[model samples]
Target: MELSFKGMTALVTGAAGGIGRATVGVLAGQGSRVWALDRVGLEQEGVEVLTGDLRGGVLLEEAIARAGRVDVAVLNAGICRPAELEQTTAANWDETIAVNLSAVFHHLQRLAGVMKKQRGGSIVITASTNSFDGEAGLIAYNASKAGLLGIVHTAANELGPYGVRVNAVCPGLIETPLTREAFDRPEVIQPYFAALPLGRGGQPEEVARAIAFLASDWASYVTGATLFVDGGQMAAKFGTWTEEKAEFAGGRWRLKPEP
Candidate 1:
């Protein structure tokens, strides 16, 4: 009924907002000495909170130094603003990749150094459902999240030898304060709900629990896996009679109801 991570040291990115804040609260409540790292304001009692962009320089260095050692590092920082493929300019794509992909790498590199010195740690990255399911307008978001799978896999293979485990959590539509307004919009959530098999989005804490599991001793042997927390979005089937293109007996295909 209770999960304990007492005395552990954790660095959580994107801690000023939604899922990150939820994770910080969950971990802190469970006894982990949490460093709530973010690029914006975050005030919490009994937590060594720091505000800074994880991209580069003094901010990251100072945070790591302050922590002394990190037993868990979560790269939960990412950005997504819906932009169509053709309409997605170079700047748009670059920003998404920078924050969602490049930022993860930056944090990983720094934290891995600290963890390796301490001889071990767990690294959880926040990927998204869009990584696997195609979202028409958010092309850059899709690519950035999908890239985390590769990063986790490669890191697991490389870091496993050092007792460091790397994994990713691909969250579905989570109902966070930031999404509350957008999802509350009839012009938005109405149509979105139709596609959600559960007919509702998930909460940030729901995803946070999964991250904790992966980062805890219970998952000591788990690594290089993408755990989807979507509301069956990845498995939802088209109403019926969807077409499938395949190389059958002689490189031909047919349109039929999938068995």
Candidate 2:
């Protein structure tokens, strides 16, 4: 593969996981001095692992100090829980938003300050296919991801003039620790795996490559876009009438997706 970031610097949040780790490895391989920030222990050779919470002010500062200048910021660190709407509590909602959406805002607030002076930068947020289609038991995950796109669009437009590009990558059922348990759960992901058109889940590196391209100057004109990396899952058709949320020309309140 070609090295697109030989002299650039990158900051990858959640570098201990699948997408983040793959990103860290790929960027570092391409000669970018990477600060792989995560809350978990990452024993990688080329990475400078900063283990801390992204929502914590101090850790963010420390990571920036270590990175010196952030040219590419890939906000890939996020958590999810399968709590139904009724079981979702205020605390869970707040934490989910904090880690997923608020933390992205926090990172952007700081990165904008740095990049504004540096004159330009790139930001890639790891959103989810959940943003496109709703899941019954993952209200918090779904809502927070949807909020991430709002941030992406607003930031892209607001920061476009500054030469900074902001975009979102929505991955569908990628292979990661986050989805491992669910996929392994005989009661859950196994049965639904067939519902996916590709007949298999995607690897984390697949998502990482797309994010790498978006963060590079190769995508100089790409911003404010949400790229769906699912294997045709979003196009699934759902059956007959479900209760509508609002009256539309299609006689449906919301979209009915099939698998």
Candidate 3:
């Protein structure tokens, strides 16, 4: 089935690269006028790139105002600076919250008003698997992501009456420029590969597809929900059984008792 947003306008943050960039492309492909926001500028067909600091909230507000009638809002801007909890400074923690959580809250607050005026709209926030699971050296990142879910739930409840839907997309280990170095290192990505039921990482477009679905009428009934685009990583975490691997064959890890 084809999803169309022919007359819709979408506001996408972090549009320069990664899943944000992919979501902008996807929305534009569906004929939605996209307002792409990021710290650095991005130039793409069918996209009006807006460059600014999300922390300041000025750019975000400007983008929302410029959209005029935003049918969909994708909150995808975030930063992950890895530092052990003990080594994490107040400055580090504040910066993370400013960009990841505060910025999102501000955007949602403004978008909620616009959508309320329009009488309806969908808001999709890009959360992380860390929102559920704790990572060793990412205390700030983890906390910010977890806080995002609270925003999603609260916003959904408040906006529901106005026909505005709010949801989050929690992505697993998706390969993106931000993660390129770590993804290229076997030591960094091998464990995720083994734990993921899909036996591999995900692509930005994979998560972007989920965002588009939530933003579109296809998920009209869905709100206050989180769609996991983790290639089964979360499922693997809770699965009762696992497929045993026999031996490496045909340049692949062969499963025992193959179905």
Candidate 4:
């Protein structure tokens, strides 16, 4: 089936950055009237750009009010402060939740009001693989992402009858501005290559495509689902057994016949 957003109106948050910027491009290219929201401004053909902080919620509400109707809402603004559980301060936790989970809730609450009355819409959130797996020094980030699942499932069930679908895209090791510096370091990037079954990092457009599909009529029957755009990272938990067998030296299960 051809995926098209012809004549649709899509509001995308965090549009200045990696995944969000790509999503704005995808939606616009697909013929949607796009509103790109971020702290920084963006300029592109067929897209209306808005700048504001997601934490305050005023900008989001204003955008919705101004648009009058929203066909698709992509909640992609989030922050990650790497602090271990014990080291995680209250401020750290609050900021992460405010931008990631709470902002999503507020946006959806507003969008649902419009969509329910209009009787149809799609909402896609940019969750993360960290939603399922815990990483050291990312307590708040992981928790907030995990919380998005609850919002997705509950919102889906409540809005399903109204033809409003809510879903999330969980990205893993995507090449984005946020990850560029770390990805540039071989010490940081090599481990992921070994763990991911696809043996490579994903691009923003890859995740954006999934988000676009979920936000389109193509996923009409799909709801409360979390799609992983992780290059098989989530499915490659046991990959180390084969890819790094040399680490098992002196064990019965060596890479070659025991001598």
TM-score of each: 0.87, 0.87, 0.92, 0.91
Q: Per-residue lDDT of 37-91 in model 1, one digit per residue for the tens? A: 8889788887887776767645667877888888988889888878889999999
Report the lDDT tens digits of candidate 2 across residue range 1-259. Answer: 4638888889999899999999898888777888888889798887788887778656678878877888999999999877989999999999999999888898888888888788899999999999878889899989999999899999998899999999999998887898887656654543354455544568888898889989988899999998878766676564222324212222112333543
lDDT of 1: 0.81
Provide the clashing-pair count of each candidate structure.
0, 6, 0, 0
Q: Pick the candidate with the highest lDDT.
A: 3
Model 3, range 1-259, lDDT digits (tens) per residue?
A: 5689999999999999799999999999998999999998988987888897877778877877777789999999999989998999999999999999999998999888889998999999999999999889999999999999999999999999999999999999888987888776776665556666666678899999999999999998999999999878788765322335543333223357756
Cα-based lDDT at residue 144, candidate 4 = 97
Judging by lDDT, tell me the better candidate of 1 and 2. 2
Error of 1 at 242 (Å): 18
Model 3, residue 49: what's the lDDT?
Answer: 85
TM-score ranking, high to low: 3, 4, 2, 1
* Model 3 TM-score, 2 decimals: 0.92
- Model 4 local distance difference test score: 0.87
Top candidate by TM-score: 3
Instruction: Quote the positional error of residue 226 for candidate 2 in Å.
Output: 0.8
What TM-score would you give candidate 1 relative to the actual structure?
Answer: 0.87
